[model samples]
Target: MNWRLVFVLFAVFAVGTNALIMAGIVPAIATGLNTSEAIAGLGLTVFALTYAVVGPTLPIILSRFGRRTIMAGGLILFIGGTVLSGLAPDVSIFMLSRVIVGVAAAAIPPQAAAIAIAISPPGREGRALGLLSAGILLSIALGVPLGSLLGIWLGYSGAFLFLASLGIVGLIGLFFIPPTPKPAKATIAEQFAPFRRPAVLVLGLCAFLFAWCQYSITTFFAPLVKDSAGISDVEVPILLVIYGLTGVVAALFGGRLIDRFSGYAVAIGGFIAITITTPLFSVASSFLIAAIVVVVWSLAQNVTFPAAQVEMGRLHPANPATAFALFAALVQAGGAIGAAVSAGVLEALGPRWIAPVAAVATLIGTIVISLLARRLRRQNEAQSILVEATVDEAS
Candidate 1:
């Protein structure tokens, strides 16, 4: 409802939108740079891999800067990257541009999320964080295809131009937003200290699994559609649209599930539900089945963070920003690893392997998550009993 959330959403939208635009422009980038499609795709892989590597580190480096200043700086980096990419005459320069974008985009999210939650009124955090998360989820759903379409219609230069323009709008929106005090600096090791909690560790691990599952299916979803259903090239984008629309619905409601039920419950429940849907996905051979499975996958995917954030807050009530930075970095790392692993599998096996691999992964993640849940419950009980004993003795 406030303008701050709007600005935060705008920043996230622009950053996420640009990151995904690479998938759309792969072929165009190849043609433009006179490289192979496989080599062109490295622009995305390198960006994601660097983001995974640098996401946690950026917050510390920007610790002395105001939140708005840091965000604006990131947008500037993105603009510069976009410009360089548009002008890049070689594959190496394009790859460099993508990495530059990755480094800047890394700084935006954790700081923005921290700002949103710090100012949020009690009990309304779920709502506020959901709004930010919704922006992120919506970008994946809506922007991917749209960016692809832009690339298709206007070519590489035009596609990069649209993305560069988005960075400008985001920067302007960020300029008007209020600045929060910079967070205290923490070394990477210290930032990760919160994971010393068993529950936090479990949450991080589950998030990793979620990323693996999502990237496996998503990176290859259209390819599966093409290979399995004999769908035409043009229809791929349309089917992807349906997949993204499902995410918007999920993002709108997933926060409530975390608010109403425990985040731990949502995590396990989401994985289980996905497990049921994976078989249907594996066998999908028509638009209808692809549509249904993709929606189910998106729904389950959207809930992972809201649910994890709830537990994260309960575990580290003091410093969610630092926690968020670590969580985000790990999530990106998981995605990078997932994409690499899935790509390897796809090469050796085939596209249909995506669903089965994801299905087995979900099951494994669920098992690990169940054990984690029990451990956290026990830890909570132990802490409660110690507190009660202290109170009784004091009386």
Candidate 2:
């Protein structure tokens, strides 16, 4: 195992925790800031929007400095943002801090994805990528629950402080990473050119739709559980721990499934899981039922990401950074929209409506993903045939 790669994965874990910890503790943050859940949810929306817009741009502007600098810089910015959020006196300032953290959070994933793809030995890219995805799930499992607990004990500001401390550890880990060669700089046109491919665009669209659906549930999960099961805020952390632990298992194993099966098959399986589980989340009446549903929902969600990342990475092997950046951008765009729209849903229709709406969206995403898989299959066959023809002609 490459320790450097492991460090990169840990950095991703820390970044993901910083970005997603809010989802688990939004209500606490809301009450602390003397705001409504809707407004607090906007913190999620703003963070995701900043990530969607700024993530891809960071690689371009910071390319001259190289990935190492970008990674270190992102952590420093994240620490600063977390400090600001901890000290924020108003909802507006808190939201602004989230935007800063989101922008900083954006820088890590593409760099991590690029590094993961670059360092993985042949035939293990899926497994390597799976490890990276697992970092995110681990955050959900470990970071979110802990953060939620911290919020209950010390308030949301304390949770922010805890997250900032984690960032410090991740920054220190960076020193052990050996110096890496700078990647060839890609032009803006080259970065965006992959969208011209029908398959790539279709995959990106599927990612967008699924992400919207996934985040719809994630952003309001604790609140929804409280409404459904009459749980106190203190209990949210424990349930989320259940949610995260199950997801961690799924993430660790999901990569092997992706490696053994086709990305298309793995993705379709995940889509089916989400389509089925998301609606169930809406109607689950008891805590036990919801916990079961959350486990399955998290499994599907955890597995789906590595499959999608692997596919996108394969799609543009020459420029993994740009390719994964576009993928992340679309996913974050979907998440931003999901957060914004779910707030309206929570206010008007109630939290019970969120999963059903997400199920509807996931159904559409599944259809598009099927088409993308078929397209890739056909493209692969054509390329194989061309290779065979050239070999025969030479013979």
Who wins the lDDT comparison? Answer: 2
Off by over 4 Å in 1: 184-189, 226-231
Q: By how many angstroms RMSD does model 2 differ from the true structure?
A: 3.2
Residue-level lDDT tens digits of model 1 in 37-63: 999988877887778788866765566
TM-score of each: 0.89, 0.86
- Model 2 stretches astray by more than 4 angstroms: 22-43, 88-96, 152-158, 222-237, 343-352
Q: What lDDT does model 2 reach?
A: 0.81
Error of 2 at 379 (Å): 1.4
The C-alpha local distance difference test score for the whole of candidate 1 amounts to 0.76
The TM-score that candidate 1 achieves is 0.89
Q: How much is 34 displaced in model 1, in angstroms?
A: 3.6
User: In candidate 2, what are the lDDT values of residues 289-395, reduced to their tens digit?
Assistant: 87888888889988888898888878876656666787899998898788779999999999888888878888998888988888778988999999999999999
lDDT of 2 at 371: 83
CA shift of 37, model 2, Å: 7.8
